[model samples]
Target: MRKLGVKAAAAAVILASPAAAEMEYSFYIGSQSAPHSVLSGTIDGTAGTAIDSTVAWEGRSTAPPPYYGMRGVYWRESGWGYGLEFTHAKAYASDADRASLGFDSLEFTDGHNIITANIHRRWKNQWWNGRLTPFVTAGVGVAMPHVDIQHGGGAHTFGYQLTGPAARLGAGVSMAITDRMSAFTEYQFTYSDNKIDLDSGGTLETSLITNALNFGISYSF
Candidate 1:
Protein backbone atom coordinates (compact mmCIF):
# COMPACT_ATOMS: atom_id res chain seq x y z
CA MET A 1 0.00 0.00 0.00
CA ARG A 2 2.89 2.38 0.69
CA LYS A 3 4.32 1.77 -2.78
CA LEU A 4 0.90 2.45 -4.30
CA GLY A 5 0.60 5.74 -2.49
CA VAL A 6 4.04 6.87 -3.74
CA LYS A 7 3.14 6.03 -7.32
CA ALA A 8 -0.13 7.98 -6.99
CA ALA A 9 1.71 11.07 -5.74
CA ALA A 10 4.19 10.87 -8.58
CA ALA A 11 1.37 10.77 -11.12
CA ALA A 12 -0.29 13.77 -9.50
CA VAL A 13 2.92 15.80 -9.57
CA ILE A 14 3.51 14.98 -13.21
CA LEU A 15 0.03 16.18 -14.10
CA ALA A 16 0.56 19.39 -12.14
CA SER A 17 3.75 20.49 -13.90
CA PRO A 18 3.58 24.11 -15.16
CA ALA A 19 3.69 24.73 -18.91
CA ALA A 20 6.36 27.40 -18.50
CA ALA A 21 8.70 24.70 -17.30
CA GLU A 22 8.29 23.52 -20.87
CA MET A 23 10.44 26.41 -22.06
CA GLU A 24 13.80 25.00 -23.25
CA TYR A 25 17.48 25.90 -23.35
CA SER A 26 19.44 25.29 -26.51
CA PHE A 27 23.09 24.80 -27.62
CA TYR A 28 24.40 24.88 -31.19
CA ILE A 29 27.32 25.40 -33.68
CA GLY A 30 27.60 26.19 -37.38
CA SER A 31 30.21 26.66 -40.13
CA GLN A 32 32.44 29.47 -38.84
CA SER A 33 33.21 31.79 -41.78
CA ALA A 34 34.00 35.51 -41.96
CA PRO A 35 34.94 37.72 -44.91
CA HIS A 36 36.86 40.98 -44.66
CA SER A 37 37.61 44.05 -46.79
CA VAL A 38 40.94 45.74 -46.14
CA LEU A 39 40.71 49.48 -46.12
CA SER A 40 43.49 52.03 -46.91
CA GLY A 41 43.05 50.02 -50.14
CA THR A 42 46.72 48.98 -50.47
CA ILE A 43 47.31 51.12 -53.51
CA ASP A 44 45.92 54.03 -51.48
CA GLY A 45 42.20 54.75 -51.28
CA THR A 46 42.10 56.73 -48.04
CA ALA A 47 43.77 59.63 -46.33
CA GLY A 48 45.97 59.12 -43.21
CA THR A 49 45.76 55.36 -43.87
CA ALA A 50 41.98 55.28 -43.68
CA ILE A 51 39.95 52.89 -45.92
CA ASP A 52 37.62 52.93 -48.91
CA SER A 53 36.29 49.44 -49.47
CA THR A 54 33.10 47.36 -49.98
CA VAL A 55 32.67 43.68 -49.19
CA ALA A 56 30.24 40.67 -49.06
CA TRP A 57 29.68 38.17 -46.21
CA GLU A 58 28.36 34.66 -45.39
CA GLY A 59 27.35 33.08 -42.03
CA ARG A 60 29.38 29.96 -41.18
CA SER A 61 27.10 27.71 -39.09
CA THR A 62 27.91 24.77 -41.42
CA ALA A 63 25.90 21.58 -40.90
CA PRO A 64 26.35 17.94 -41.77
CA PRO A 65 23.47 16.01 -43.41
CA PRO A 66 20.44 14.27 -41.78
CA TYR A 67 18.86 17.07 -39.68
CA TYR A 68 20.11 19.27 -42.49
CA GLY A 69 18.23 22.49 -41.62
CA MET A 70 18.15 22.00 -37.84
CA ARG A 71 20.59 24.84 -37.33
CA GLY A 72 18.65 26.60 -34.58
CA VAL A 73 17.41 25.73 -31.07
CA TYR A 74 14.48 27.07 -29.05
CA TRP A 75 15.33 29.83 -26.53
CA ARG A 76 14.02 30.38 -23.00
CA GLU A 77 11.09 32.70 -22.41
CA SER A 78 11.85 35.11 -19.59
CA GLY A 79 15.60 35.52 -19.17
CA TRP A 80 18.98 34.64 -20.61
CA GLY A 81 19.49 32.03 -23.34
CA TYR A 82 22.98 30.57 -23.14
CA GLY A 83 24.49 28.79 -26.16
CA LEU A 84 27.62 28.75 -28.29
CA GLU A 85 27.61 29.49 -32.06
CA PHE A 86 30.58 29.00 -34.42
CA THR A 87 30.86 31.38 -37.36
CA HIS A 88 32.91 31.20 -40.63
CA ALA A 89 33.06 33.83 -43.36
CA LYS A 90 35.16 35.15 -46.30
CA ALA A 91 35.69 38.59 -47.94
CA TYR A 92 37.06 39.99 -51.19
CA ALA A 93 37.21 43.29 -53.07
CA SER A 94 36.85 43.58 -56.87
CA ASP A 95 38.54 46.93 -56.62
CA ALA A 96 41.53 45.68 -54.58
CA ASP A 97 43.17 43.93 -57.55
CA ARG A 98 46.81 44.01 -58.80
CA ALA A 99 45.85 46.86 -61.13
CA SER A 100 46.15 48.76 -57.85
CA LEU A 101 49.92 48.09 -57.41
CA GLY A 102 49.62 46.83 -53.77
CA PHE A 103 49.97 43.37 -55.30
CA ASP A 104 53.17 43.36 -57.33
CA SER A 105 52.32 39.67 -57.85
CA LEU A 106 49.38 38.55 -55.69
CA GLU A 107 47.33 36.24 -53.49
CA PHE A 108 45.42 36.92 -50.24
CA THR A 109 42.89 35.34 -47.84
CA ASP A 110 40.71 36.56 -44.90
CA GLY A 111 38.37 34.82 -42.47
CA HIS A 112 37.02 35.17 -38.90
CA ASN A 113 35.59 33.21 -35.92
CA ILE A 114 33.00 34.50 -33.42
CA ILE A 115 31.18 33.31 -30.27
CA THR A 116 28.09 34.91 -28.72
CA ALA A 117 25.38 35.03 -25.97
CA ASN A 118 21.96 36.65 -25.85
CA ILE A 119 18.78 37.62 -23.92
CA HIS A 120 15.37 36.52 -25.19
CA ARG A 121 11.62 37.09 -24.98
CA ARG A 122 9.16 34.55 -26.31
CA TRP A 123 6.74 36.69 -28.34
CA LYS A 124 3.76 34.40 -27.84
CA ASN A 125 2.67 32.57 -24.58
CA GLN A 126 6.11 33.53 -23.37
CA TRP A 127 7.30 35.08 -20.13
CA TRP A 128 4.27 37.10 -21.16
CA ASN A 129 2.04 34.19 -22.18
CA GLY A 130 2.73 30.45 -22.27
CA ARG A 131 0.74 29.73 -25.43
CA LEU A 132 2.22 32.31 -27.78
CA THR A 133 5.67 30.83 -28.20
CA PRO A 134 7.16 33.12 -30.83
CA PHE A 135 10.42 34.75 -29.72
CA VAL A 136 13.18 37.27 -30.51
CA THR A 137 16.68 37.96 -29.18
CA ALA A 138 19.71 40.28 -29.37
CA GLY A 139 23.23 39.86 -28.02
CA VAL A 140 26.96 40.39 -28.46
CA GLY A 141 29.93 38.28 -29.58
CA VAL A 142 33.71 38.25 -30.08
CA ALA A 143 35.50 37.60 -33.37
CA MET A 144 38.97 36.33 -34.24
CA PRO A 145 40.00 36.74 -37.87
CA HIS A 146 43.04 35.25 -39.56
CA VAL A 147 44.48 37.38 -42.33
CA ASP A 148 46.92 36.12 -44.99
CA ILE A 149 48.38 38.50 -47.52
CA GLN A 150 50.80 37.40 -50.25
CA HIS A 151 52.39 40.38 -51.86
CA GLY A 152 55.82 41.71 -52.86
CA GLY A 153 57.16 38.10 -52.92
CA GLY A 154 56.29 37.30 -49.30
CA ALA A 155 53.50 36.16 -46.97
CA HIS A 156 52.32 38.27 -44.04
CA THR A 157 50.06 37.05 -41.22
CA PHE A 158 47.88 39.30 -39.09
CA GLY A 159 45.46 38.03 -36.48
CA TYR A 160 42.61 40.23 -35.36
CA GLN A 161 40.29 40.10 -32.32
CA LEU A 162 36.98 41.95 -32.52
CA THR A 163 33.99 42.39 -30.21
CA GLY A 164 30.67 44.09 -30.90
CA PRO A 165 26.87 43.89 -31.07
CA ALA A 166 24.62 41.31 -32.72
CA ALA A 167 20.88 40.75 -33.07
CA ARG A 168 18.53 37.81 -33.90
CA LEU A 169 14.81 37.33 -34.65
CA GLY A 170 12.64 34.29 -35.44
CA ALA A 171 9.45 32.39 -34.70
CA GLY A 172 9.28 29.38 -32.36
CA VAL A 173 7.94 26.01 -33.44
CA SER A 174 7.76 22.67 -31.63
CA MET A 175 10.94 22.49 -29.47
CA ALA A 176 11.95 18.87 -29.84
CA ILE A 177 12.45 15.77 -31.95
CA THR A 178 11.08 14.12 -28.82
CA ASP A 179 10.75 15.06 -25.14
CA ARG A 180 13.91 16.25 -23.24
CA MET A 181 15.25 17.75 -26.45
CA SER A 182 14.26 20.90 -28.37
CA ALA A 183 15.34 22.83 -31.48
CA PHE A 184 14.95 26.26 -33.09
CA THR A 185 16.45 28.36 -35.89
CA GLU A 186 16.65 32.11 -36.34
CA TYR A 187 18.11 34.67 -38.74
CA GLN A 188 20.99 36.51 -37.08
CA PHE A 189 23.62 39.11 -38.00
CA THR A 190 26.80 40.17 -36.20
CA TYR A 191 28.65 43.40 -36.96
CA SER A 192 32.26 44.11 -35.97
CA ASP A 193 35.24 46.11 -37.12
CA ASN A 194 38.38 43.93 -37.52
CA LYS A 195 41.49 46.12 -37.73
CA ILE A 196 45.26 45.74 -37.93
CA ASP A 197 47.44 48.74 -37.04
CA LEU A 198 51.03 49.08 -38.26
CA ASP A 199 53.80 50.95 -36.43
CA SER A 200 54.30 52.98 -39.62
CA GLY A 201 50.80 54.43 -39.20
CA GLY A 202 49.68 52.39 -42.24
CA THR A 203 46.71 50.23 -41.22
CA LEU A 204 44.24 47.69 -42.60
CA GLU A 205 40.77 47.75 -41.10
CA THR A 206 38.34 45.25 -42.58
CA SER A 207 35.15 46.22 -40.85
CA LEU A 208 34.21 42.55 -41.03
CA ILE A 209 30.49 42.74 -41.67
CA THR A 210 29.12 39.19 -41.25
CA ASN A 211 25.88 37.40 -42.09
CA ALA A 212 25.51 33.81 -40.93
CA LEU A 213 23.54 30.72 -41.90
CA ASN A 214 23.60 29.28 -38.35
CA PHE A 215 22.18 25.90 -37.24
CA GLY A 216 22.53 23.61 -34.17
CA ILE A 217 20.88 21.28 -31.54
CA SER A 218 20.28 21.19 -27.73
CA TYR A 219 19.17 19.19 -24.71
CA SER A 220 17.24 20.65 -21.76
CA PHE A 221 17.16 20.05 -17.99
Candidate 2:
Protein backbone atom coordinates (compact mmCIF):
# COMPACT_ATOMS: atom_id res chain seq x y z
CA MET A 1 0.00 0.00 0.00
CA ARG A 2 2.84 2.42 0.83
CA LYS A 3 4.57 1.76 -2.52
CA LEU A 4 1.32 2.20 -4.43
CA GLY A 5 0.69 5.55 -2.69
CA VAL A 6 4.16 6.82 -3.60
CA LYS A 7 3.73 5.77 -7.23
CA ALA A 8 0.36 7.55 -7.45
CA ALA A 9 1.82 10.73 -5.99
CA ALA A 10 4.68 10.68 -8.49
CA ALA A 11 2.25 10.24 -11.37
CA ALA A 12 0.22 13.19 -10.15
CA VAL A 13 3.32 15.39 -10.00
CA ILE A 14 4.28 14.37 -13.50
CA LEU A 15 0.88 15.30 -14.81
CA ALA A 16 1.13 18.72 -13.14
CA SER A 17 4.48 19.62 -14.72
CA PRO A 18 4.80 22.21 -17.44
CA ALA A 19 5.96 19.53 -19.84
CA ALA A 20 2.37 18.36 -19.86
CA ALA A 21 1.02 21.86 -20.53
CA GLU A 22 -0.72 23.15 -23.60
CA MET A 23 1.14 24.57 -26.61
CA GLU A 24 -0.45 27.30 -28.63
CA TYR A 25 0.39 28.77 -32.04
CA SER A 26 -1.07 32.04 -33.25
CA PHE A 27 -1.04 34.14 -36.44
CA TYR A 28 -2.13 37.74 -36.72
CA ILE A 29 -2.42 40.70 -39.09
CA GLY A 30 -2.31 44.21 -37.78
CA SER A 31 -2.18 47.92 -38.48
CA GLN A 32 0.69 49.92 -37.04
CA SER A 33 1.42 53.61 -36.47
CA ALA A 34 4.36 55.62 -35.22
CA PRO A 35 5.17 59.16 -34.17
CA HIS A 36 7.73 61.58 -35.56
CA SER A 37 11.36 61.07 -34.59
CA VAL A 38 14.65 62.67 -35.38
CA LEU A 39 16.97 60.89 -37.79
CA SER A 40 20.56 61.96 -37.21
CA GLY A 41 23.73 60.70 -38.77
CA THR A 42 26.63 61.45 -41.03
CA ILE A 43 25.89 61.28 -44.73
CA ASP A 44 28.58 59.95 -47.04
CA GLY A 45 30.20 62.95 -48.68
CA THR A 46 29.83 66.07 -46.57
CA ALA A 47 33.31 65.67 -45.08
CA GLY A 48 31.83 63.55 -42.23
CA THR A 49 29.55 66.31 -40.99
CA ALA A 50 26.62 64.90 -38.92
CA ILE A 51 23.15 66.22 -39.73
CA ASP A 52 19.97 66.07 -37.70
CA SER A 53 16.49 66.24 -39.10
CA THR A 54 13.02 65.45 -37.74
CA VAL A 55 11.23 62.87 -39.87
CA ALA A 56 7.48 62.29 -40.20
CA TRP A 57 6.59 58.67 -40.64
CA GLU A 58 3.65 56.86 -42.22
CA GLY A 59 2.46 53.40 -41.30
CA ARG A 60 1.12 52.32 -44.68
CA SER A 61 0.01 49.14 -42.94
CA THR A 62 -2.13 47.88 -45.77
CA ALA A 63 0.44 48.55 -48.42
CA PRO A 64 2.35 45.93 -50.37
CA PRO A 65 4.35 44.68 -47.40
CA PRO A 66 1.66 44.41 -44.77
CA TYR A 67 2.13 44.09 -41.03
CA TYR A 68 1.88 40.61 -39.55
CA GLY A 69 2.98 38.52 -36.60
CA MET A 70 3.22 34.97 -35.30
CA ARG A 71 3.76 33.44 -31.90
CA GLY A 72 4.24 30.11 -30.18
CA VAL A 73 3.32 29.83 -26.51
CA TYR A 74 3.33 27.20 -23.82
CA TRP A 75 0.65 27.70 -21.20
CA ARG A 76 0.75 26.12 -17.81
CA GLU A 77 -2.39 25.01 -16.01
CA SER A 78 -1.79 27.83 -13.52
CA GLY A 79 -2.54 30.42 -16.23
CA TRP A 80 1.09 31.52 -16.63
CA GLY A 81 2.80 31.06 -19.98
CA TYR A 82 5.92 31.80 -21.97
CA GLY A 83 6.39 32.21 -25.68
CA LEU A 84 8.32 33.58 -28.61
CA GLU A 85 6.91 36.04 -31.10
CA PHE A 86 7.93 37.71 -34.33
CA THR A 87 6.35 40.91 -35.66
CA HIS A 88 6.91 42.49 -39.04
CA ALA A 89 6.20 46.17 -38.66
CA LYS A 90 7.01 49.04 -41.02
CA ALA A 91 7.75 52.76 -41.33
CA TYR A 92 8.12 55.23 -44.17
CA ALA A 93 9.23 58.81 -44.18
CA SER A 94 6.52 61.20 -45.31
CA ASP A 95 7.02 62.94 -48.62
CA ALA A 96 7.18 66.33 -46.98
CA ASP A 97 9.77 65.10 -44.53
CA ARG A 98 11.79 63.59 -47.34
CA ALA A 99 11.77 66.90 -49.20
CA SER A 100 12.57 68.91 -46.10
CA LEU A 101 15.27 66.55 -44.98
CA GLY A 102 16.74 66.46 -48.48
CA PHE A 103 16.54 62.72 -48.82
CA ASP A 104 15.29 61.10 -52.02
CA SER A 105 13.93 58.06 -50.18
CA LEU A 106 14.04 56.73 -46.62
CA GLU A 107 12.03 53.82 -45.34
CA PHE A 108 12.09 50.56 -43.49
CA THR A 109 9.06 49.25 -45.34
CA ASP A 110 10.31 45.78 -46.18
CA GLY A 111 10.15 45.75 -42.49
CA HIS A 112 11.19 46.57 -39.01
CA ASN A 113 11.08 43.08 -37.62
CA ILE A 114 11.14 42.18 -33.93
CA ILE A 115 11.65 38.79 -32.36
CA THR A 116 10.97 38.43 -28.66
CA ALA A 117 10.68 36.08 -25.75
CA ASN A 118 7.55 36.80 -23.78
CA ILE A 119 5.87 36.06 -20.52
CA HIS A 120 2.10 35.87 -20.45
CA ARG A 121 -0.63 35.61 -17.89
CA ARG A 122 -4.31 34.96 -18.37
CA TRP A 123 -7.39 34.95 -16.21
CA LYS A 124 -10.11 32.39 -16.49
CA ASN A 125 -13.53 33.94 -16.35
CA GLN A 126 -17.08 32.72 -16.40
CA TRP A 127 -17.95 34.87 -19.40
CA TRP A 128 -19.27 33.69 -22.77
CA ASN A 129 -19.98 30.31 -21.28
CA GLY A 130 -16.50 30.15 -19.74
CA ARG A 131 -14.86 30.52 -23.13
CA LEU A 132 -13.53 34.04 -22.66
CA THR A 133 -10.02 34.66 -21.35
CA PRO A 134 -8.18 37.93 -20.91
CA PHE A 135 -4.40 37.99 -21.15
CA VAL A 136 -1.42 40.33 -21.07
CA THR A 137 2.11 39.89 -22.28
CA ALA A 138 5.50 41.60 -21.92
CA GLY A 139 8.58 40.89 -23.94
CA VAL A 140 12.14 41.96 -24.79
CA GLY A 141 13.68 41.50 -28.16
CA VAL A 142 15.88 42.75 -30.95
CA ALA A 143 15.16 44.78 -34.05
CA MET A 144 16.32 43.47 -37.40
CA PRO A 145 15.27 45.94 -40.06
CA HIS A 146 15.64 46.06 -43.78
CA VAL A 147 17.30 49.40 -44.25
CA ASP A 148 16.30 51.23 -47.41
CA ILE A 149 17.72 54.73 -47.64
CA GLN A 150 18.85 57.04 -50.39
CA HIS A 151 20.14 60.58 -50.48
CA GLY A 152 20.50 62.89 -53.46
CA GLY A 153 23.01 61.09 -55.68
CA GLY A 154 24.30 58.79 -52.93
CA ALA A 155 24.55 55.05 -52.29
CA HIS A 156 21.23 53.30 -51.66
CA THR A 157 21.40 51.08 -48.61
CA PHE A 158 18.96 48.19 -49.01
CA GLY A 159 19.25 45.00 -47.00
CA TYR A 160 18.53 43.41 -43.65
CA GLN A 161 20.67 44.41 -40.71
CA LEU A 162 20.61 43.96 -36.96
CA THR A 163 19.71 47.42 -35.79
CA GLY A 164 19.02 47.37 -32.05
CA PRO A 165 16.98 46.42 -29.01
CA ALA A 166 13.20 46.32 -28.82
CA ALA A 167 10.52 45.75 -26.25
CA ARG A 168 6.76 45.25 -26.32
CA LEU A 169 3.70 45.05 -24.12
CA GLY A 170 0.29 43.78 -25.08
CA ALA A 171 -3.16 43.03 -23.73
CA GLY A 172 -6.00 41.09 -25.29
CA VAL A 173 -8.97 38.85 -24.82
CA SER A 174 -9.43 35.49 -26.46
CA MET A 175 -12.71 33.67 -27.06
CA ALA A 176 -12.71 30.01 -27.64
CA ILE A 177 -14.40 28.83 -30.81
CA THR A 178 -13.57 25.22 -30.11
CA ASP A 179 -11.61 23.30 -27.50
CA ARG A 180 -8.45 23.70 -29.52
CA MET A 181 -9.13 27.01 -31.27
CA SER A 182 -9.57 30.59 -30.15
CA ALA A 183 -9.97 34.02 -31.69
CA PHE A 184 -8.40 37.13 -30.23
CA THR A 185 -7.94 40.83 -30.65
CA GLU A 186 -5.03 42.65 -29.06
CA TYR A 187 -3.42 46.06 -28.66
CA GLN A 188 0.36 46.19 -28.57
CA PHE A 189 2.97 48.86 -28.05
CA THR A 190 6.54 48.37 -29.19
CA TYR A 191 9.67 50.46 -28.85
CA SER A 192 12.82 50.05 -30.87
CA ASP A 193 16.08 51.95 -30.83
CA ASN A 194 17.78 51.68 -34.17
CA LYS A 195 21.40 52.41 -34.96
CA ILE A 196 21.60 51.39 -38.57
CA ASP A 197 24.57 51.42 -40.93
CA LEU A 198 24.32 53.56 -44.02
CA ASP A 199 25.82 52.31 -47.25
CA SER A 200 27.49 55.63 -47.90
CA GLY A 201 29.68 54.93 -44.85
CA GLY A 202 28.10 56.11 -41.61
CA THR A 203 25.41 55.26 -39.05
CA LEU A 204 21.87 56.57 -38.62
CA GLU A 205 20.22 56.52 -35.25
CA THR A 206 16.53 56.80 -34.42
CA SER A 207 14.06 55.61 -31.83
CA LEU A 208 10.57 54.49 -32.76
CA ILE A 209 7.46 53.96 -30.70
CA THR A 210 4.70 52.07 -32.46
CA ASN A 211 1.15 51.18 -31.55
CA ALA A 212 -0.65 48.31 -33.19
CA LEU A 213 -4.08 46.74 -33.20
CA ASN A 214 -4.14 43.07 -34.09
CA PHE A 215 -6.74 40.46 -34.88
CA GLY A 216 -5.92 36.80 -34.98
CA ILE A 217 -6.66 33.15 -34.33
CA SER A 218 -4.85 30.58 -32.25
CA TYR A 219 -4.66 26.81 -32.22
CA SER A 220 -3.71 24.81 -29.18
CA PHE A 221 -2.35 21.29 -28.84
Per candidate, the number of residue pairs that clash is 31, 0
lDDT at position 175, candidate 1: 42
| Model 2, residue pairs in steric clash | none
Tens digit of per-residue lDDT, candidate 1, span 1-221: 99999999998888766544434445444443445544544322244433354443333233322111222334443434544444444443434454353533221233444455555555433432343244555556665555444344434444553533433333343344555654555555556665544323344555555454445555655
TM-score, every prediction = 0.54, 0.94
Question: Compared to the true structure, candidate 2 yields what TM-score?
Answer: 0.94
The root-mean-square deviation over C-alpha atoms between each candidate and the true structure, in angstroms, is 7.6, 1.7
How many angstroms is residue 87 displaced in model 2 relative to the true structure, after the best TM-score fit? 0.4
Each prediction's whole-model lDDT (CA): 0.45, 0.89
For model 2, residues 1-221, the per-residue Cα lDDT tens digits are 99999999999998778566899999999889978898888876446647698888888899988999999999988889999999999999999998877778889988889889999999866477788999999999999988888887688899999999999999999999988899999999989999988889878899987899999999999
Question: lDDT at 184 for candidate 2?
Answer: 95
Best of the candidates, lDDT: 2
Candidate 1 lowest-lDDT run of ten: 63-72
